[model samples]
Target chain A: MRKRLRNDILLIGGVLLIAAAFALIFFLTRKEGAYAAVMKNGTEIARYALSAEGEYPITDGETVTNLLVIRGGKAEIAEATCPDQICVNHRAVSKAGETIVCLPQEVVIKIVAETKNAPDMVV
Target chain B: MRNKKTKKLAFLGLCTAVTLILAYVEALLPPLWAAVPGIKMGLPNIMLLFLLYRFSVKEAAAVSLVRLFAVALLFGNIMTLAYSFAGAVLSLAVMNLLKRIDRFSMVAVSIMGGIFHNLGQVLVAILVLETAEIGYYMIVLTVTGTIAGILIGLAGYLVLKYLKQKEI
Candidate 1:
């Protein structure tokens, strides 16, 4: 029984260590986003530079409206017509790979780096 | 023999009910991390771990599936069902595999189940949302899942100890 307890602790410790390492790598490798890509129904509808501060309204037909605001090198959904309002409540994102998804509106706002080596297909 | 089979069935049914109730209670609680959609304390997993240890893998899997469908039918939509179904299946698979290997303790199996559960959900999110960008959330999810796993695993450990004492 004592051996079992020891084994459990060791296993949990190892997993926590691995998770911490991944988190550290994630934080260190996170880069400032250069563009906010507005995607509707899985397709990139528009791209706005994070360097430029502006507000863009993304609409899907007549039913949905998501107001995306870029300011201070960060992007956020300022207003959303969706009932949940989860997207509007999301915090501003400035790091590449951050995303604000309005599932109701099928709108996805993702941050991406403007890299010369930007892959044609990012998997 | 008939009486024993009836008892087994009754136990499985009771386990399923317990798991569903735990899921419902967790759902009622407000989001721990507003940024993440699927983050939860995974209270139901404690029950699942208990079932896994106290019963057969087949019984555990059956109860888990029933719980998933029941929860989805009562409180979730199609998307929720998709994410949860994927998570539950993957988590069970991992736990069962670990149990078969028989090297790690039950707590270790539970933790691995929790981590894989989140990974399974993330995979579904990537597919359903049609964006690979969601993969970035894996780091946060993994960390949270590990914590939740530890809590659930500890609870399962205590319960297992008590059950052993009672010879249940």
Candidate 2:
């Protein structure tokens, strides 16, 4: 019992430290400006931008779902065929703290900022 | 003596197969929450932690090597394999070294492995990209590593318990 208590304390301390670290990252890290989309099946499926709007299609071979468009820098699963429909519930992602995951479709859309002096940018 | 040696070799082979399967399984899982391009859940580490305790260090190393190569071939992502392999090797070394300390539990060791694993991978990315700023993801990586390590450690603990009772 005493050993378990010690372990619990350690875990809690670890969690606190991680929280602090995330807080630091939240403040210290700057959002990269350029935006890019992760397309599926040659369609403009998911968009990552500060502000924009357009039609997108979600295709799974034979079937296709028309996803509603969100104009701006936010990613969301506007439509899907999966039974869960959890993807639609995902709010539009903006501010680098966002992610829209479609598990059944194996699609992950995210936004990332490129670092300054990024070799690609440097050259 | 020769027969015993053969049995040991077979056992090592089996462990290698199990590790390979686990790693490949993780690759198949949907990257739903992968907001960043390279982030992953790495569920296979669960099997790794289990092997570290159930089998010998040499056996675990064998498993890691075979798993790395097999996954690389199967996924056809040579760059990712290269980075992941570097991380896994470094993490395994750290775990083995920490295993020598009596006070460290398997779970703690696994957490250390997770932290080092991400650190090593991030370092590889930085080097490959020729950009030091990629290191800014260190905090995020550490957070994810801690969570993943703990989850895998829990799985290891459960499996170990079941094995102890079943005598498997």
Candidate 3:
């Protein structure tokens, strides 16, 4: 019984350690993105450099509308016509690979670095 | 022997019903993390762990699949179904493997299952969204998954202990 308990403790400790390592690696290697890509229906409709601050309106004719704001190296959805308002509520994202998705309108705003060596796979 | 088979089938159905009810209750609750889309308490996983421990893997798999479909039909859309189906299958497979290893306790198994569940959903999200950036969400999801897994594992441990005491 003592052995079993010890094993359980070891297992839990190992998991925690692994989680901490991964978190540390993620934060340490995090890159600030240079561009924000506005995608609608799985296609990029517009791209803006995060170096400049601006507010852009994203619309798919009369069907969907979202207001995107980029400032201080961060990008966010300031307003959205989607019912859930999830994208608007999401925190501004400046790091590479961050994304704000408005599911109702199929709008996806993603941060991307200008580097040509961006990993194609993240497994 | 026939009677015993019938009883086992009935018990499996009961487990499935219980799982579905738990999933429904979880869905009714407000989002635990507003920023993430699929975060939840994973209440139904407690039932899955219990079923896996007490019964055969096939029986547990049956209950898990049925509960997924039932909940999706009642309260979720296609996207929810897809994400959940992937997570459930991956978690169950990992738990079953861990159980077979016989080295880890139920709590450890459940925690691993929870982490894999999040990993599976993130994989599906990446595919559906056509972007690798979704992988970044895995960090937050893994942390939340671990917490939820611990809760579910503790609940399962308590219930299993009670059942053993009752000789059920």
Candidate 4:
């Protein structure tokens, strides 16, 4: 019984150590993003600067209305016509690599860090 | 003989029903923090863990699969079903491994199950979303899954303790 108890603690401790490591990495790498790039069907449709606060209604012309609200340097889906509304309920994201995905609508709001030094912001 | 077989089958059905109800309750709940997408308490897993300890892996898997399909059909779509099925299969496999090893406690097994379940779902999410960035959510999810796993393990442990002395 004692041996089993020790094994359990060791296993839990090991898993927590890994989780903590990832958490540390996330914390360190987290950066305020500059753009909220909206992608539809794996291709970029719209790009909004996080510095500019506005409500952008992203739609595929008719269906899939996801209101991308950029406020206070963070982006959130204020309203969504999707059934699950997982995107709407999600908290606003500001981190450079953060994303909010509405699978049903095939809309992905990705936070891209646009820096003058790094050259990836040609879009 | 036949009586014992009937008893096992009936118990399986009961287990499946209880898990299905718990799944419904979970489905009704909004996301835990409304921040993380898949951060679930995994309440239905309490029964799955109970069955894993009380009976065998086969029994637990049977109940889990039944509960998954029933819940999906009732409250979810093809997407939800896909991720859930992935989570359930991965969780059951890990839990069964821990049980076979017999070194870890129910809590440990339960925690591993929760971790693997989220891992599986994240994998499926990465595939469907076609992005590796979503893997970052697993960091937050790892902590949430541990808490949920501990709760489930405690509940399952209590149920197992009392049920151990009783006729199921």
Give the proportion of true interface contacts each model preserves, from 0 to 1: 0.47, 0.02, 0.41, 0.65
Model 3 chain A: which ten-residue window has the lowest total lDDT?
A114-123
Docking outcome class, model 1? acceptable
Q: Candidates sorted by DockQ, descending order?
A: 4, 1, 3, 2
B1-168, model 4: which lDDT tens digit per residue?
889889879988987888888888887887778777878889889998988888888889888888878877887778889999999999999999988988998998999999999999999888887777888888888888999999999999998888887775
Q: Per-residue error at B51 for model 2, in Å?
A: 2.6
Q: Would you list the rank order by TM-score, best first? A: 4, 1, 3, 2
The residue pairs found clashing in candidate 1 are: none
lDDT of 4 by residue, A6-115 (tens): 99989988988998998888789888898888887777778888888988888778764889999999999999988888899988998888999888787889998876
DockQ of each: 0.45, 0.08, 0.41, 0.66
lDDT of 2 by residue, A1-123 (tens): 467547645854685487577677776774643443443422334444445455456556667643545556555667888654556766565545334545445454445464443232110
Candidate 2: tens digits of C-alpha lDDT, residues B23-134: 7677667654534434556666776777678765666677788888877787646776878788999988887876665456777777778878888987875565444444
TM-score of 2: 0.63
Error of 2 at B22 (Å): 1.2
In Å, candidate 3's interface RMSD is 2.6
Q: Which residues of candidate 3, in runs, are more than 4 Å off?
A: A40-43, A51-55, A60-62, A79-85, A103-106, A115-123, B165-168
Model 3 residue B77 CA deviation in Å: 2.5
The best candidate by DockQ is 4
Candidate 3 structure quality by residue, lDDT tens digits, B28-120:
787777767667788988988988988757888999998888887886778779988999999999999989988888887888889899889
Clashes of each: 0, 5, 0, 0
The runs of at least 3 residues in candidate 1 whose Cα sits more than 4 Å from the true structure, single-residue gaps closed, are: A1-14, A17-21, A81-85, A115-123, B163-168
Off by over 4 Å in 2: A1-19, A22-123, B164-168
How do the residues B79-134 of candidate 1 rate in per-residue lDDT, one tens digit apiece?
Answer: 77888899999999999888887778877888889989998988987787789887
User: Which DockQ-derived CAPRI band holds candidate 3?
Assistant: acceptable
